[model samples]
Target chain A: MNEAAASLVADDGVPLKLKLRRAERAHKLKSVAMIAPLFLFLLLSFVLPIGTLMYRSVDNPELHRALPQTVAALAGWDTQALPDEPVFAALVRDLRKAQEESTLGLASRRLNYEISGFSSLLTKLVRKLPPEGAGVRDAVIAVDERWGQLTYWRAIARAGTPLTSFYLLKAVDHRVNEAGDIESVPANEAAYVTVFGRTFWIALIVTLWALALGFPVAYLLATLPSGPSNLLMILVLLPFWTSLLVRTAAWIVLLQSGGILNGAMIGLGLIAEPLQLVFNRFGVYVAMVHILLPFMILPLYSVMKGISPAYVRAAVSLGAHPFLAFWRVYVPQTIAGVAAGCLLVFILAIGYYITPALVGGPDDQMVSYFVAFFTNRTINWGMASALGTLLLIATLVLYAVYGKLASSDANKARR
Target chain B: MQPYATPIERVWFYAFRVICGLVLLYLVLPILVIVPLSFNSSSFLTYPLSGFSMRWYEEFFGSHEWMMALKNSLIVAPSATVLATCFGTLAAVGLTRGEFPGKALVMAILISPMVVPIVIVAVGLYFFFADIGLLNTYAGLILAHAALGVPFVIITVTATLQGYNTNLSRAAASLGAPPLTVFFKVVLPLILPGVVSGALFAFATSFDEVVVTLFLASPTQRTLPQQMFGGIRENISPTIACVATIMIVLSVLMLLTMEWLRRRNEKLRGAG
Candidate 1:
């Protein structure tokens, strides 16, 4: 057959293949056109902001923006010793600009991250700076003697880099020592590692507890007849549907020192006095588990519901023990649900800010608390972004695992 | 019924039911506990019912702060819900209908708001909104909330669209109706329940969102949850319980509405 004649033609004698390609392109364009509005809206309102956050973690703009001339001038200076006249002159010029621009505190605030008292040192240096003069270095040193130290100049140099790992390093409880190698801070200052540890630890405990409590309830819902199961399902769903603030508020009311639960216990003479329930680890666990149990149960119930009872019945009829048969034949079918539910609960638990803030004690605060602390109280954007990036990493990694399990489960169902 | 033959089996059966019952009790009890506490007449939130009164509810409704919060919630939740429903439904339809490159990545990004730590979002938006002068404005809060609400609408609407048959629309189109008419007449009627459900979800999301409001809202724009957060944090009062009860009732009503829609959807599918 002739190649030209082999292809079919449309009614207008155009090649059908080209026509089909044109039609497909039009369809895609239509779809994209429809999606563009929402996509752009999200990009501007949500995704861009998140991107800004991730960037802020390592952005290092404060030092770079405040002292552009000093940062540029220090690029050629070796870390071994003090700088020469031009570098001091650039510092003077940068400080004058910062003073006039009202950004003197920024460079100093950044240096303070490296050394404790550097903030006030830089502030005083700026405040007491006489008019631009020949001996700017000596004048600055006279204002604050610490400014003459090489260590402080090294901090300025380290922060003056366009992108600094200072915040990220600090987040893991490590610091760049005077020798320029990463090392753990002294034991007393090493707080973030413990905080991260506690975050994951709390999340794990809550996930396991939720699974322990939710599995049986999910099993009952799966095994019961439709009439009873539907009624029982409301108990799970009503709480799930309720506002989180309301649920957390209710827990506060129930567990406060003079609250109903403690009062009830006292009235019944269950204990000599009211328990220290709220604002502690015990309260955190109870509220978190209560908040997250539905996530675990709903997934587990969906998975258990699909499993046929016949498998277990047949195993028992064939002389296998009922419990063993249930475990062997039935339990395996629900792993997908268990994995999804546990991971979901763990993920949510780690990101928890509101519930823990309300119910947990000072020691019970997690990484999210520090993130908010840095953002709100301290105005430490770098620190906030660094901790947030870690959480974003954990969430994405776990979400990837969950995505795998869910898709594989779908595949199993397809078969 | 004959499944249990051994004595251990019978014993395990009762024990399992009792355990499940307790779990259910644990799930539902906290929500119910506040209902009575809200009605308690005592100034201090104690037990044994100091006697029922509507004083707390009266205070909640009568306070200017609570009333303003309620007004703000009404304004924000509805506007955000409308925006989320329109955009999310359109996007979900497009996502389901058309083939696209990087569809999965796009989807993941769209829903990432629900996954990312809200604190990070708050910080990022805090700076961003400040830059654009959206900080402390009702528009800023509403826009942020709408973004948060979009994922729910997309998830639900995409689900409904997946279960849809394209043949009905094809028939409508072949009968000489325009594209918009086919959509409004054939496609929308089938998906209206889903849209409504998604709207309810989006509404609830906006209504409940506090972290974003904490960063974004000025005192003039304080929301119900923000006000409650302050109340719970600064001072413990039954008025907070009263607010919680109202929120609980609202959510229960939403849940019932969702259930009704689910049944109706099933009936529609069955009839079809």
Candidate 2:
């Protein structure tokens, strides 16, 4: 062969390097072409909407949308005292325009979230305003003395912006005070911080319970002969494939006060009366653990199935205790599965809404319950989205961890 | 467990089996308890049936509301599954074949809907759909459900493509078959099981979806889960149990079908 031969060339006029580059470019283009329809569909349907949802947590557009001049009037004023007469004039003029547009409740209801009284205050002003716009500030003040107070104006000024952290702050049990410093709401008003804690608490309990129950079952499936193992595997997968609503409904029927569990317990004289099982935190734990146990078991079983039993046997043959050999040799190999399963079960558990709502009492509600409450019961989009954003953060962070573990586990397997 | 283990070790083995048996019982009990309750003659959801009867089953089949929900579910799940399979199969092939920057990022975006809480996705879609006047429309529900189903298709098809032999398609192309023809003729037959299972998964996703429907659907567009949700919220009825029993049977059938397909797929690959 020629030691320093000229670079190879394609049959085409182009050099080989450029030809390879063109081929690579074509490959990328083909893939992108295939992915385009789905990518665009998801972009419009899933990605964009969630982006808008995250934006909605800090969004307070109703006041700004309906009362633009009033917001502009308060642009220069700090959160100190009331603004000058011009700002009041701007408020009254904006109020009439909002009324004429039939959007008074839009501005007033948003302002009411910031401070509790402005809904009625502004709602009263639209009807009491003069036939004309002149002396409108006095006419508005005559309608409600509280509107004349700086507290009311501060509420307006704080919420008047197109973007505010009122909802996000409120989600964490903190709010922007009249002084405009971020402060915790009075203890009595604090609710969401507890709800967030309760969500995490419930998810953790479910994960632990699932782990305890699933480990032995997974071990049984992994170690047993094919005959018994297949039956056990079906037991796991059957519940897994069942409808989530059906399983939850089953729990409701079984755990209700006069339901089967109670009926059996009383028949056996296990307790004096039927216990409060469903519609409480106990039922939440029971149902969630039952639902998530398969997720826990499947991963652990897969990892355990790959591990050879010879290592444990080797330790036992070397005069080590059987329990010691099994624990030291076998358990370490399954940590990846354990972590994967626990995180997965935890992630799914935290976002549970239908099961908890169907079985849980008021006090047993998780953050998702409150998210639905704000969306459905109160029509408070800000509060709903803020809590949702928080839950999304929790899930995404855990998923990232899971992805890391999973990829590393796969890399190890490949090696 | 070793044959030469001490007495305690033998006891531990037996004890472990019992514990595992109890856990298996726990897993199946909730599912089984609903069956007899669905057939109870009385109106009460509690135990102690007055008599064995088919009244709840009759009510479930006879009700207009339940029939409408079942029809809506049927309409939505199949349409979404079709769209999801087409998009997902194409994307999976594209992803496996091409080298591109930010491929991981694209995959992450495609799968994000699966991780995000249903409540978040529901409200987000609600407000966004309202902007384009899609709320309460069947089209809106179907499109949203289809988006949710696509990731499953992508995942299953991509997994299937991983074990694929590329030389067959290359041979087809070399014989002057068009790329589309090679895909349809050479590759499609081999990967059909993956496509079918992915479609089944997508269908299941769309069928079981309720929270999104809660925000998007009106009374007219209510799905089966939403109907059950309303029933559970308002009152405990044996009819709900009857519906639950039917769904459980459906899942059992689906599981058996999946198991059969998996074995058949394995056998075909083994022969090849």
Q: Which structure among the candidates has the greatest TM-score?
A: 1
Write one digit per residue (lDDT tens) for candidate 1, span A1-415: 5566548898999987788889999989888887889999998889888788888888887778988888898999888989877777888888888889898776778888889898887777777765666887787777777778899888888888878788888889888888799998899998888999999999999999999999999989998999899899989999998999888988888888887788888888998788999999999999999999999999999999989889988998898887789889989988989999999999888999999999999999999999999999989989999998888898889888887788788898899
For residues A124-236, could you state the per-residue lDDT of candidate 2 as single tens digits? 77767654345656666777878678888877878888788898899999998867799999999999999999999999999999999999899889999978897779899
Interface RMSD of 2: 1.3
Instruction: Give per-model TM-scores.
Output: 0.97, 0.96
TM-score of 2: 0.96
Q: What C-alpha RMSD separates each model from the true structure? A: 1.8, 2.0
Q: Report the Cα lDDT for residue A29, model 2.
A: 96
Best-matching candidate per DockQ: 1
For each candidate in the order shown, give its overall lDDT on alpha carbons: 0.89, 0.87
- Candidate 2 accuracy as lDDT: 0.87
lDDT of 1 at A141: 77
Q: After superposition, how far is residue B269 of candidate 2 from its true place, in Å?
A: 3.1
Candidate 2 local lDDT, B205-255, one digit each (tens): 888888999999989999998898888778779999999899889888877
